[model samples]
Target: MFRKEYTRIESSTQHSSVNEFVVINIPEEDVEPKQIILDPDDQPMWESAKIVAPTPNSAIIQLDVDDNFVINSTHLKMILENKFDGYLRADPHDHIREFLAICDMFKYGEMHSEVVKLLIFPFFLCDKAKTWFNELNEESIISWEQMRRAFINRFFPPSLFNRLLLEIRNFSQNICESLTEDWLRLKNMLQKCHGHSLAKGVIIQIF
Candidate 1:
């Protein structure tokens, strides 16, 4: 280690000025300055730069199934084989309908149908849909009904509902469209917008 010593000396001039003199003392032996390295794992407890604690594996949806209720990988694979990425043209109502249909085909003995649907629902989403699901409050959705409502509310907003309602109200057969084709078109539109709640009599009257 090199030691530094400082001395103050006053100049004997008309205007006295104090000058600082520093003397550095070096050891006789040739020595290099020691370099200290800190192990990444041994970071100081108070250090802000310390490695962040590993994030807990939190899920958006909570499953209240029994301990024995194991998720079947085969079912998961089958459900995820077709992913919904929340595209602008993709119908969320149709996606939910298809998802429920797929869930209905599977039988899990004593497990409730809600449990089965809730467990398998997340696997069928990708890209933007998956991102939206993840951004939902942690474990906020625990039931199939709640999940369904949330999904519908997120994808099918009020503006879209109003627009679809207007379209359904103003539904008219085109000059070249047949009665069968026009009826099918109106049915398809209604299907696209779930919970239209328009009475059958009113729908018929509108047509």
Candidate 2:
């Protein structure tokens, strides 16, 4: 092996009292494979550089922005075609948080990876939420039941209603360890979120 192993070191000493570091050294077989495994998972791990809507109407930032946050009106109109449904279209809460972090970094020129978790978990499963869920993961949101219910709700036709309900109920039971309120919130939130088809279209089509 050209490189014997990959090493990771983590440290925290900002308080000026003490510093801490954790390093993981993994045996690497091939440079290419190691790089593949480390290339941000071929997913959106929100970086300030990835913020495409610089002043809006420029490029696309993966997360949706809405009542919780506002993008430049020009960009909003460009993407949504001026017929914004409402705050219901508010960029998903977690997404807004990530973008705001990027905005902060842009304004202040600081980097915060604290929410990188917010950018990774959703795309942890690629079948749903399409490919953009991880643009930000400041909040590590994992409500398997919510995801299950959402999947069934979107993919299950009326014919599978009973099975869908059963699956949801079972998911709720398994995830009871989390507070009922949080799970319900996630379920309700997912219930309100539009399906992945919301914005995947040619920009010119909307314009």
- C-alpha lDDT of all candidate models, in order: 0.72, 0.34
TM-score against native, each model: 0.67, 0.16
Q: Candidate 2: where are CA atoms >4 Å away?
A: 1-124, 127-142, 159-207
lDDT of 2 by residue, 1-207 (tens): 444333332322222111232223344555522311122232235532645663422111243323344233433233333221213233343343443344344321123232222222233233234332333233333343343344334444454445434443344333455565656754653443434232424212322
Question: Which pairs of residues collide in candidate 1?
Answer: none
Off by over 4 Å in 1: 1-49, 53-68
Global Cα RMSD, each model: 11.7, 23.3
